[model samples]
Target: MKFPRRRRDPVEVNLTPLIDVVFLLLIFFMVSTTFETRQALELELPESAAGTALEASPVTLVVTERGRYRLGERELGAAELGEALSAEADQARLHGLVVEADARAVHADVVRALDQAGALGVRQVRIATRETQATSTQAETP
Candidate 1:
Protein backbone atom coordinates (compact mmCIF):
# COMPACT_ATOMS: atom_id res chain seq x y z
CA MET A 1 0.00 0.00 0.00
CA LYS A 2 1.39 3.47 -0.91
CA PHE A 3 1.67 6.12 1.88
CA PRO A 4 -0.26 9.42 1.40
CA ARG A 5 1.87 12.59 1.27
CA ARG A 6 1.08 15.38 3.78
CA ARG A 7 0.75 18.92 2.37
CA ARG A 8 2.01 22.07 4.21
CA ASP A 9 0.36 25.54 3.77
CA PRO A 10 2.58 28.67 3.12
CA VAL A 11 2.63 31.40 5.84
CA GLU A 12 2.40 35.07 4.70
CA VAL A 13 0.83 38.45 5.69
CA ASN A 14 -0.71 40.88 3.06
CA LEU A 15 0.45 44.54 3.68
CA THR A 16 -1.45 46.24 0.78
CA PRO A 17 -4.64 46.67 2.87
CA LEU A 18 -2.71 48.14 5.83
CA ILE A 19 -0.89 50.62 3.53
CA ASP A 20 -4.18 51.64 1.89
CA VAL A 21 -5.81 52.24 5.29
CA VAL A 22 -2.88 54.43 6.45
CA PHE A 23 -2.96 56.46 3.23
CA LEU A 24 -6.71 57.01 3.55
CA LEU A 25 -6.32 58.26 7.12
CA LEU A 26 -3.59 60.67 6.04
CA ILE A 27 -5.74 62.05 3.21
CA PHE A 28 -8.77 62.42 5.52
CA PHE A 29 -6.76 64.35 8.13
CA MET A 30 -5.20 66.55 5.49
CA VAL A 31 -8.59 67.42 4.02
CA SER A 32 -10.19 68.13 7.41
CA THR A 33 -7.32 70.09 8.97
CA THR A 34 -7.26 73.92 8.70
CA PHE A 35 -3.92 75.71 8.64
CA GLU A 36 -3.72 79.18 10.18
CA THR A 37 -1.13 81.74 9.11
CA ARG A 38 0.89 83.34 11.89
CA GLN A 39 3.30 86.26 12.10
CA ALA A 40 6.26 86.85 14.38
CA LEU A 41 5.24 90.42 15.08
CA GLU A 42 1.98 92.12 14.19
CA LEU A 43 2.74 95.58 12.85
CA GLU A 44 0.38 98.54 12.44
CA LEU A 45 1.68 100.99 9.87
CA PRO A 46 0.83 104.66 10.13
CA GLU A 47 -2.08 105.82 8.00
CA SER A 48 -2.04 109.06 6.05
CA ALA A 49 -5.37 109.91 4.47
CA ALA A 50 -4.21 112.91 2.49
CA GLY A 51 -0.67 111.71 1.99
CA THR A 52 0.56 110.87 -1.46
CA ALA A 53 2.10 107.49 -2.18
CA LEU A 54 5.81 107.57 -1.40
CA GLU A 55 8.43 106.47 -3.87
CA ALA A 56 11.58 104.69 -2.68
CA SER A 57 14.51 106.95 -1.78
CA PRO A 58 18.13 105.95 -1.55
CA VAL A 59 19.52 108.74 0.65
CA THR A 60 17.87 110.04 3.81
CA LEU A 61 19.34 113.14 5.46
CA VAL A 62 18.41 114.00 9.01
CA VAL A 63 19.03 117.50 10.34
CA THR A 64 19.11 118.10 14.07
CA GLU A 65 17.94 121.23 15.88
CA ARG A 66 21.55 122.39 16.23
CA GLY A 67 22.22 121.90 12.51
CA ARG A 68 24.01 118.58 12.79
CA TYR A 69 23.73 116.32 9.76
CA ARG A 70 23.03 112.58 9.73
CA LEU A 71 23.08 110.15 6.85
CA GLY A 72 20.71 107.39 7.79
CA GLU A 73 21.66 107.34 11.49
CA ARG A 74 25.31 107.97 10.79
CA GLU A 75 26.59 111.42 11.65
CA LEU A 76 28.02 113.21 8.61
CA GLY A 77 29.82 116.55 8.66
CA ALA A 78 28.98 119.34 6.25
CA ALA A 79 32.18 118.63 4.29
CA GLU A 80 31.37 114.93 3.72
CA LEU A 81 27.77 115.69 2.81
CA GLY A 82 28.33 116.13 -0.89
CA GLU A 83 30.81 113.27 -1.27
CA ALA A 84 28.63 110.82 0.62
CA LEU A 85 25.45 111.70 -1.27
CA SER A 86 27.31 111.57 -4.56
CA ALA A 87 28.60 108.08 -3.81
CA GLU A 88 25.10 106.88 -2.93
CA ALA A 89 23.56 108.48 -6.03
CA ASP A 90 26.21 106.95 -8.29
CA GLN A 91 25.69 103.52 -6.81
CA ALA A 92 21.93 103.68 -7.02
CA ARG A 93 21.97 105.21 -10.53
CA LEU A 94 18.48 106.67 -10.12
CA HIS A 95 18.12 107.84 -6.52
CA GLY A 96 15.87 110.02 -4.37
CA LEU A 97 16.61 112.18 -1.34
CA VAL A 98 14.40 112.55 1.73
CA VAL A 99 15.03 115.19 4.37
CA GLU A 100 13.77 114.75 7.92
CA ALA A 101 14.60 117.82 9.96
CA ASP A 102 13.78 118.90 13.47
CA ALA A 103 11.37 121.80 13.80
CA ARG A 104 14.21 123.98 15.02
CA ALA A 105 16.70 122.88 12.38
CA VAL A 106 18.61 125.62 10.59
CA HIS A 107 16.93 126.60 7.32
CA ALA A 108 20.30 127.05 5.64
CA ASP A 109 21.35 123.50 6.48
CA VAL A 110 18.19 122.01 5.00
CA VAL A 111 18.62 124.09 1.86
CA ARG A 112 22.21 122.97 1.63
CA ALA A 113 21.11 119.31 1.66
CA LEU A 114 18.67 119.95 -1.15
CA ASP A 115 21.38 121.69 -3.13
CA GLN A 116 23.64 118.67 -2.68
CA ALA A 117 20.93 116.35 -3.92
CA GLY A 118 20.39 118.58 -6.94
CA ALA A 119 24.09 118.62 -7.68
CA LEU A 120 24.10 114.81 -7.54
CA GLY A 121 21.40 114.62 -10.25
CA VAL A 122 18.77 113.34 -7.83
CA ARG A 123 15.46 114.60 -9.17
CA GLN A 124 13.20 113.27 -6.42
CA VAL A 125 13.42 115.15 -3.12
CA ARG A 126 10.90 115.42 -0.31
CA ILE A 127 10.67 116.84 3.19
CA ALA A 128 9.16 114.66 5.91
CA THR A 129 7.01 116.04 8.72
CA ARG A 130 5.19 114.49 11.66
CA GLU A 131 1.41 114.64 11.87
CA THR A 132 -0.01 114.56 15.41
CA GLN A 133 -2.06 116.50 17.92
CA ALA A 134 1.09 117.26 19.92
CA THR A 135 2.75 118.69 16.84
CA SER A 136 -0.22 120.96 16.23
CA THR A 137 -0.26 122.02 19.88
CA GLN A 138 3.44 122.76 19.82
CA ALA A 139 3.05 124.87 16.75
CA GLU A 140 0.19 126.82 18.36
CA THR A 141 2.12 127.45 21.58
CA PRO A 142 5.17 129.02 19.91
Candidate 2:
Protein backbone atom coordinates (compact mmCIF):
# COMPACT_ATOMS: atom_id res chain seq x y z
CA MET A 1 0.00 0.00 0.00
CA LYS A 2 1.27 3.54 -0.91
CA PHE A 3 1.01 6.37 1.70
CA PRO A 4 -0.23 9.80 0.52
CA ARG A 5 1.32 13.15 1.82
CA ARG A 6 -1.08 15.75 3.55
CA ARG A 7 -1.28 19.28 2.13
CA ARG A 8 -0.59 22.26 4.49
CA ASP A 9 -3.09 25.13 4.88
CA PRO A 10 -1.99 28.83 4.53
CA VAL A 11 -2.23 31.21 7.54
CA GLU A 12 -4.39 34.38 7.38
CA VAL A 13 -5.19 37.37 9.68
CA ASN A 14 -8.68 39.02 9.93
CA LEU A 15 -8.59 42.80 10.62
CA THR A 16 -12.36 43.51 10.75
CA PRO A 17 -12.52 43.30 14.55
CA LEU A 18 -9.45 45.51 15.00
CA ILE A 19 -10.88 48.16 12.67
CA ASP A 20 -14.20 48.13 14.51
CA VAL A 21 -12.50 48.62 17.90
CA VAL A 22 -10.45 51.55 16.56
CA PHE A 23 -13.59 53.27 15.25
CA LEU A 24 -15.40 52.80 18.56
CA LEU A 25 -12.50 54.44 20.44
CA LEU A 26 -12.49 57.37 18.02
CA ILE A 27 -16.22 57.96 18.50
CA PHE A 28 -15.90 57.75 22.30
CA PHE A 29 -13.27 60.47 22.38
CA MET A 30 -15.15 62.70 19.97
CA VAL A 31 -18.31 62.58 22.11
CA SER A 32 -16.85 62.74 25.63
CA THR A 33 -14.21 65.43 25.27
CA THR A 34 -14.72 69.11 26.02
CA PHE A 35 -12.53 71.96 24.73
CA GLU A 36 -11.98 75.32 26.40
CA THR A 37 -10.21 78.44 25.24
CA ARG A 38 -7.94 79.88 27.92
CA GLN A 39 -6.65 83.41 28.21
CA ALA A 40 -2.90 84.03 28.16
CA LEU A 41 -2.99 86.11 31.36
CA GLU A 42 -4.80 85.64 34.67
CA LEU A 43 -6.96 88.47 35.92
CA GLU A 44 -8.87 89.41 39.07
CA LEU A 45 -12.05 91.00 37.79
CA PRO A 46 -14.31 93.34 39.73
CA GLU A 47 -17.77 92.35 40.96
CA SER A 48 -20.90 93.33 39.07
CA ALA A 49 -24.62 92.97 39.65
CA ALA A 50 -25.30 92.09 36.00
CA GLY A 51 -22.41 90.02 34.72
CA THR A 52 -22.81 86.99 32.49
CA ALA A 53 -20.38 84.37 31.22
CA LEU A 54 -19.77 83.92 27.53
CA GLU A 55 -19.72 80.61 25.64
CA ALA A 56 -16.81 81.66 23.41
CA SER A 57 -13.38 83.22 23.94
CA PRO A 58 -13.06 86.95 23.48
CA VAL A 59 -10.10 89.32 23.25
CA THR A 60 -9.61 90.75 26.76
CA LEU A 61 -8.96 94.43 27.44
CA VAL A 62 -8.04 95.27 31.03
CA VAL A 63 -8.47 98.78 32.45
CA THR A 64 -6.46 99.48 35.60
CA GLU A 65 -7.43 101.91 38.37
CA ARG A 66 -4.89 104.40 37.12
CA GLY A 67 -6.82 104.76 33.82
CA ARG A 68 -4.34 102.61 31.93
CA TYR A 69 -5.76 100.40 29.19
CA ARG A 70 -4.30 97.02 28.26
CA LEU A 71 -4.94 94.42 25.57
CA GLY A 72 -4.18 91.13 27.21
CA GLU A 73 -0.89 92.16 28.91
CA ARG A 74 0.26 94.90 26.56
CA GLU A 75 -0.61 98.44 27.51
CA LEU A 76 -1.98 100.69 24.78
CA GLY A 77 -2.95 104.36 24.73
CA ALA A 78 -6.32 105.56 23.48
CA ALA A 79 -4.82 106.70 20.20
CA GLU A 80 -3.20 103.30 19.46
CA LEU A 81 -5.80 100.93 20.84
CA GLY A 82 -7.65 100.63 17.55
CA GLU A 83 -4.49 99.87 15.59
CA ALA A 84 -3.44 97.24 18.10
CA LEU A 85 -6.83 95.55 18.01
CA SER A 86 -6.81 95.59 14.21
CA ALA A 87 -3.39 93.99 14.16
CA GLU A 88 -4.60 91.26 16.48
CA ALA A 89 -7.71 90.74 14.36
CA ASP A 90 -5.50 89.86 11.40
CA GLN A 91 -4.33 86.73 13.23
CA ALA A 92 -7.65 85.65 14.76
CA ARG A 93 -10.50 83.96 12.94
CA LEU A 94 -13.43 84.83 15.23
CA HIS A 95 -13.44 88.32 16.68
CA GLY A 96 -14.93 89.18 20.07
CA LEU A 97 -13.85 91.67 22.73
CA VAL A 98 -14.24 91.82 26.50
CA VAL A 99 -13.46 94.87 28.60
CA GLU A 100 -12.47 94.19 32.19
CA ALA A 101 -12.66 97.47 34.03
CA ASP A 102 -11.48 97.99 37.59
CA ALA A 103 -14.13 98.96 40.12
CA ARG A 104 -12.33 102.25 40.69
CA ALA A 105 -11.87 102.99 37.00
CA VAL A 106 -14.11 105.46 35.25
CA HIS A 107 -16.95 104.12 33.09
CA ALA A 108 -15.95 106.37 30.18
CA ASP A 109 -12.65 104.57 29.87
CA VAL A 110 -14.38 101.24 29.50
CA VAL A 111 -16.71 102.66 26.91
CA ARG A 112 -13.78 104.05 24.96
CA ALA A 113 -12.14 100.63 24.83
CA LEU A 114 -15.38 99.09 23.65
CA ASP A 115 -15.60 101.67 20.92
CA GLN A 116 -12.08 100.89 19.82
CA ALA A 117 -12.85 97.18 19.71
CA GLY A 118 -15.93 97.87 17.64
CA ALA A 119 -13.93 99.99 15.24
CA LEU A 120 -11.64 97.03 14.70
CA GLY A 121 -14.65 94.95 13.52
CA VAL A 122 -15.26 93.06 16.74
CA ARG A 123 -19.00 92.42 16.57
CA GLN A 124 -19.40 90.85 20.00
CA VAL A 125 -18.33 92.82 23.09
CA ARG A 126 -18.77 92.03 26.76
CA ILE A 127 -17.69 93.41 30.17
CA ALA A 128 -15.92 91.15 32.61
CA THR A 129 -16.70 90.79 36.34
CA ARG A 130 -16.24 88.38 39.21
CA GLU A 131 -18.94 86.52 41.07
CA THR A 132 -19.51 87.57 44.66
CA GLN A 133 -17.95 85.21 47.16
CA ALA A 134 -20.10 84.19 50.13
CA THR A 135 -17.17 83.81 52.55
CA SER A 136 -17.37 86.16 55.52
CA THR A 137 -14.15 88.15 55.22
CA GLN A 138 -15.58 91.19 56.99
CA ALA A 139 -18.73 91.26 54.93
CA GLU A 140 -19.74 94.48 56.70
CA THR A 141 -16.46 96.28 55.93
CA PRO A 142 -17.94 98.03 52.93
Candidate 3:
Protein backbone atom coordinates (compact mmCIF):
# COMPACT_ATOMS: atom_id res chain seq x y z
CA MET A 1 0.00 0.00 0.00
CA LYS A 2 1.33 3.52 -0.91
CA PHE A 3 0.79 6.47 1.55
CA PRO A 4 -0.17 9.94 0.30
CA ARG A 5 2.13 12.93 1.31
CA ARG A 6 0.43 16.13 2.53
CA ARG A 7 1.92 19.64 1.85
CA ARG A 8 2.50 21.82 5.01
CA ASP A 9 1.36 25.41 5.16
CA PRO A 10 3.91 28.25 5.79
CA VAL A 11 4.49 29.23 9.48
CA GLU A 12 3.31 32.77 10.24
CA VAL A 13 3.78 34.87 13.46
CA ASN A 14 0.79 37.01 14.52
CA LEU A 15 2.11 40.37 15.80
CA THR A 16 -1.19 41.90 16.98
CA PRO A 17 -0.76 40.70 20.55
CA LEU A 18 2.93 41.69 20.55
CA ILE A 19 2.04 45.16 19.32
CA ASP A 20 -0.67 45.47 21.98
CA VAL A 21 1.82 44.44 24.72
CA VAL A 22 4.38 47.00 23.49
CA PHE A 23 1.81 49.77 23.58
CA LEU A 24 0.62 48.75 27.04
CA LEU A 25 4.24 48.83 28.29
CA LEU A 26 4.72 52.25 26.71
CA ILE A 27 1.58 53.58 28.43
CA PHE A 28 2.64 52.09 31.77
CA PHE A 29 6.05 53.75 31.59
CA MET A 30 4.56 57.09 30.59
CA VAL A 31 2.06 56.98 33.45
CA SER A 32 4.67 55.86 36.02
CA THR A 33 7.34 58.45 35.18
CA THR A 34 7.51 61.45 37.56
CA PHE A 35 8.16 64.88 36.11
CA GLU A 36 8.73 66.96 39.26
CA THR A 37 11.70 65.65 41.27
CA ARG A 38 12.79 66.48 44.81
CA GLN A 39 14.69 64.65 47.50
CA ALA A 40 12.54 63.27 50.32
CA LEU A 41 13.15 64.42 53.88
CA GLU A 42 11.35 63.58 57.11
CA LEU A 43 10.42 66.96 58.51
CA GLU A 44 7.36 69.05 59.23
CA LEU A 45 8.34 71.91 56.94
CA PRO A 46 6.74 75.28 57.49
CA GLU A 47 3.81 76.02 55.23
CA SER A 48 3.74 78.90 52.78
CA ALA A 49 1.73 80.05 49.82
CA ALA A 50 4.68 80.45 47.47
CA GLY A 51 6.80 77.31 47.86
CA THR A 52 7.95 75.81 44.59
CA ALA A 53 9.69 72.51 43.82
CA LEU A 54 13.34 72.53 42.94
CA GLU A 55 14.30 71.08 39.57
CA ALA A 56 17.96 70.34 40.29
CA SER A 57 19.04 68.16 43.16
CA PRO A 58 20.71 70.41 45.68
CA VAL A 59 22.75 69.58 48.76
CA THR A 60 20.06 69.07 51.41
CA LEU A 61 20.66 70.26 54.97
CA VAL A 62 17.98 69.21 57.43
CA VAL A 63 17.71 71.03 60.74
CA THR A 64 15.72 69.30 63.43
CA GLU A 65 13.59 71.00 66.06
CA ARG A 66 16.19 70.08 68.68
CA GLY A 67 18.93 72.01 66.84
CA ARG A 68 20.56 68.93 65.27
CA TYR A 69 21.89 68.97 61.74
CA ARG A 70 21.74 66.28 59.03
CA LEU A 71 23.47 66.72 55.67
CA GLY A 72 22.64 64.28 52.93
CA GLU A 73 22.05 61.56 55.58
CA ARG A 74 25.08 62.29 57.79
CA GLU A 75 24.41 63.64 61.28
CA LEU A 76 26.95 66.24 62.33
CA GLY A 77 27.76 68.35 65.34
CA ALA A 78 27.22 72.09 65.31
CA ALA A 79 30.92 72.59 64.58
CA GLU A 80 31.03 69.80 61.98
CA LEU A 81 28.09 71.27 60.08
CA GLY A 82 30.23 74.08 58.74
CA GLU A 83 33.04 71.70 57.77
CA ALA A 84 30.68 69.37 55.96
CA LEU A 85 29.03 72.21 54.10
CA SER A 86 32.44 73.57 53.13
CA ALA A 87 33.43 70.22 51.66
CA GLU A 88 30.17 70.06 49.70
CA ALA A 89 30.80 73.55 48.41
CA ASP A 90 34.30 72.52 47.31
CA GLN A 91 32.82 69.94 44.96
CA ALA A 92 33.20 70.92 41.28
CA ARG A 93 29.58 70.30 40.30
CA LEU A 94 27.73 71.45 43.41
CA HIS A 95 24.41 72.67 42.03
CA GLY A 96 23.04 74.46 45.10
CA LEU A 97 22.11 74.14 48.80
CA VAL A 98 18.68 73.49 50.29
CA VAL A 99 17.85 74.20 53.92
CA GLU A 100 14.97 72.11 55.28
CA ALA A 101 14.07 73.35 58.74
CA ASP A 102 11.45 72.02 61.05
CA ALA A 103 8.55 74.37 61.71
CA ARG A 104 9.27 74.33 65.44
CA ALA A 105 13.03 74.68 65.08
CA VAL A 106 14.73 77.56 66.79
CA HIS A 107 15.10 80.57 64.55
CA ALA A 108 18.76 80.97 65.50
CA ASP A 109 19.60 77.42 64.49
CA VAL A 110 18.22 77.91 60.99
CA VAL A 111 19.95 81.27 60.80
CA ARG A 112 23.21 79.69 61.91
CA ALA A 113 22.96 77.12 59.10
CA LEU A 114 22.30 79.91 56.64
CA ASP A 115 25.24 81.83 58.03
CA GLN A 116 27.51 78.82 57.52
CA ALA A 117 26.35 78.36 53.93
CA GLY A 118 26.88 82.03 53.23
CA ALA A 119 30.32 81.97 54.81
CA LEU A 120 31.24 79.01 52.59
CA GLY A 121 30.37 81.11 49.49
CA VAL A 122 27.41 78.94 48.42
CA ARG A 123 25.62 81.23 45.99
CA GLN A 124 22.36 79.37 45.43
CA VAL A 125 20.57 78.58 48.68
CA ARG A 126 16.89 77.64 48.96
CA ILE A 127 14.73 77.23 52.06
CA ALA A 128 12.22 74.42 51.65
CA THR A 129 8.60 74.88 52.67
CA ARG A 130 5.36 73.03 52.06
CA GLU A 131 2.47 74.57 50.16
CA THR A 132 -0.19 76.25 52.28
CA GLN A 133 -3.76 75.07 52.04
CA ALA A 134 -6.18 77.42 50.30
CA THR A 135 -9.10 76.73 52.63
CA SER A 136 -8.48 79.79 54.75
CA THR A 137 -11.66 81.82 55.07
CA GLN A 138 -9.82 85.01 56.07
CA ALA A 139 -8.41 86.65 53.00
CA GLU A 140 -5.72 89.27 53.15
CA THR A 141 -5.83 91.89 50.42
CA PRO A 142 -2.32 92.46 49.08
Model 1 residue runs over 4 Å out of place are 1-56, 91-95, 132-142
Measured by TM-score, the strongest candidate is: 3
lDDT of 2 by residue, 1-142 (tens): 9989888788789899999999999999999997542354344578866767775455677887667777755787778777777877743327566677887887787888777766666777777788877667755755
Tens-digit lDDT track of model 1 for 39-67:
32122223334556576566667776666
Which regions of candidate 2 fall more than 4 Å away from where they truly are?
1-44, 55-58, 90-95, 135-142
Give the TM-score comparing model 2 with the true structure, all chains together: 0.55
| Residue-by-residue lDDT tens digits, candidate 3, 1-142 | 9989889999999999999999999999999997633255457989988777776455888898889898866888788998888878865136778788999999999999999988888877888898987787888899
Candidate 3 TM-score versus the reference: 0.63
Q: Any idea what lDDT model 3 has?
A: 0.83
Model 3 misplaced stretches (Cα beyond 4 Å): 1-41, 91-93, 136-142
lDDT of each: 0.70, 0.72, 0.83
Winner by lDDT: 3
Greater-lDDT candidate between 1 and 3: 3
Q: Candidate 1, residue 103: CA error in Å?
A: 0.8
Ten contiguous residues with the weakest lDDT in model 2: 35-44
